[model samples]
Target: MSAARIFAVMVKEFTQLTRDRLTYALILVMPIVQLLLFGYAINNDPHHLPTAVLIQDDSAFARSTLGAIAHTDYFDIVETARTPAELTQAMARGRVQFTITIPGDFTRRVVRGDRAQILVEADASDPSATGAAVAALAGLPQEALKRDLLGAVAPARAAAPPFEVVVHRRYNPEAIAAYNIVPGLLGVILSMTLVMMTALGVTREYERGTMESLLATPVKPIEVMIGKLAPYVLVGLIQTVVILALARVLFDVPMAGGWGVLSVGTMLFIVGSLALGFLLSTVARTQLQAMQMSVFYILPSILLSGFMFPFRGMPDWAQWIGTIIPVTHFLRVVRGALLKGLGFADLWQSLGALSLFVVVVVSLAMARYRTTLD
Candidate 1:
């Protein structure tokens, strides 16, 4: 190519970019924002994980053990569980990430200089979140005993500590990466397909000039939006079944939860995804712009949805940003249901949030829809 022709093309592209300030801003500023979000937000070594305690013993030693876990930033003891059911419920609700079950005889065994066991139930459905926190527990007693053993009648300082921390990694005993990733793929895939499909569907109507004809037929905006979105629910179901089947057959991923529960949650998430696509369609004048916006949304879906990394590994601010993302909530629903056998009681929070997303996005799409035929 001639140097003069190359320069002319470059100048023409710059002029076009200047005319489209929004696209230019996204090109320049999006990368910087994405870097800050991914760099400062993501943390492989998650800390201060919300935790609950099941105290079986009322003894001083047991109290000391609780304090020691709470003292570290690795575990944030949110509440005390009165029974095993409460702890399980907490796990299902995503209220607590871990459960520290101090057996009833723990204090007695420790005082008697016998081997005592403390069970730490970790929701290892996402192994990365628990890996560092579980590894940090090895020296927990050493930290606890530093205060307790000031003048203890128990085992001396040089002797082996009488307690053993038993970490029971629930749902993912082997810590297989596939077990975590397989379920997450459902949400990621659903978001990508549902959003892009609906966005392209509506944009294609604009490209074909059928939108003006439809708008002239007295069809309400909400009705048109609903009509465009309804077919995608069936499509989402087919995709969900295929992905789940592949996960079970190829990766041996377990589906401990009820099918009914998983189906309902998946439906809500799918509806939300389609609603978002409808919203994006109203903002995009062309199919190409719709595709670009879908890609922009996909970035957050992959990065902030706990698919590429641990959800809790990110800083609190990033997590708050993640909270508003529909895919993030769907990931929790899928993982909790398939891995933990979580029922409505445990998954209602995410399901509710996803439902709200559908409502809000559909409302926005309805409001943004242009009823006038051009």
Candidate 2:
């Protein structure tokens, strides 16, 4: 090819690309998103995990051990109570990431050179998130007693304290990856299919050159938008039932919560995802761009919504970004229901966030849809 002809083609291509401002901006923005995700947000070795303590003994050894746990960056004690039920409720609501229980006989056992157990319960829904923090527990009591028991009678000052840590991984007790992944799969699968399917709606109509004829008919923009959305919403719900059944039968992932709660949450999530797709469809001028935009939105949800990583593991800013994603809240609903046996009251904030997402996205789509063929 001649140099002059190559230069002319380059100019024409750049001109076309520049005219598509959304694509142009996204192209620039994705690299920055990547930079933030890699450099600042994505830490494989997570620390300072939220922890709750159940200290039934209120003994000196227990106090010393709790202080030691606080010193380590592995856990941050945010709540303390005397009952297991209280802490379990906190875990069910996702208010706390871990629970440490000091048994009433801890001091007596340690003094007598008996193996005293410190019960540490972890929310192991995402195993990777808890793996590091749990691993850090191996040498805790020994290290704590070495410092705490300088003048104590006998066994308390022994080289290794008679105390041992007993770890209980809650939810996914076996640490089975499938049990965790399957529940999150509900969110991931729904997000991928539902968003992409509806994202193609208006772009499909535009590409087929049927927009003019459709606008010529006596249909309001709101009605036309609803018509485009209704069928996909049904498809989403149908997929939800199929997936939930398969997860139960094939994977044996437990549905610990009520059927009614799961049904309501699935409906809210599907509608929100559909609204998101409709919003994307309104913004994108072509089907390819619609797919691109949806993918842009989808990638961060998968990475930051506590699917691939622990929700508590992510940095504060990344977690803040995740809160805006409907998939993030929806995953909490699914996981809490399926694994923790949580009910509506424990899960209302997440459901409310999803409803708010639908309202905002639907409102934007309504504003963006034009009655004219253009």
Which prediction has the highest TM-score against the true structure? 1
lDDT of 1 at 71: 72
Name every residue pair that clashes in candidate 1.
none
- In the range 122-160, model 1's lDDT, one tens digit per residue, is 988888999989988898866676656546654444456
**Tens digit of per-residue lDDT, candidate 2, span 1-374:** 69999999999999999998878888998889877774677777789999999998888788888888888899999998668899888787888889999999988888776788889999988788889888888878768776555555554565465688999999899888877888898898899998999999898888898987888999998898788889988898888889889999999998887566777888988888988898899888899899998888888888888887777778898889889888899898898888888889888998889889888998999999888865
User: How well does each candidate superpose onto the true structure, as a TM-score?
Assistant: 0.94, 0.93
The 10-residue segment with the lowest total lDDT in model 2: 150-159
Candidate 1 global TM-score: 0.94
lDDT, residue 49, candidate 1 = 94
* Backbone clash tally (model 2): 0
Candidate 2: where are CA atoms >4 Å away?
1-15, 152-155
Check candidate 2 and list the clashing pairs.
none
How does candidate 2 fare on TM-score? 0.93
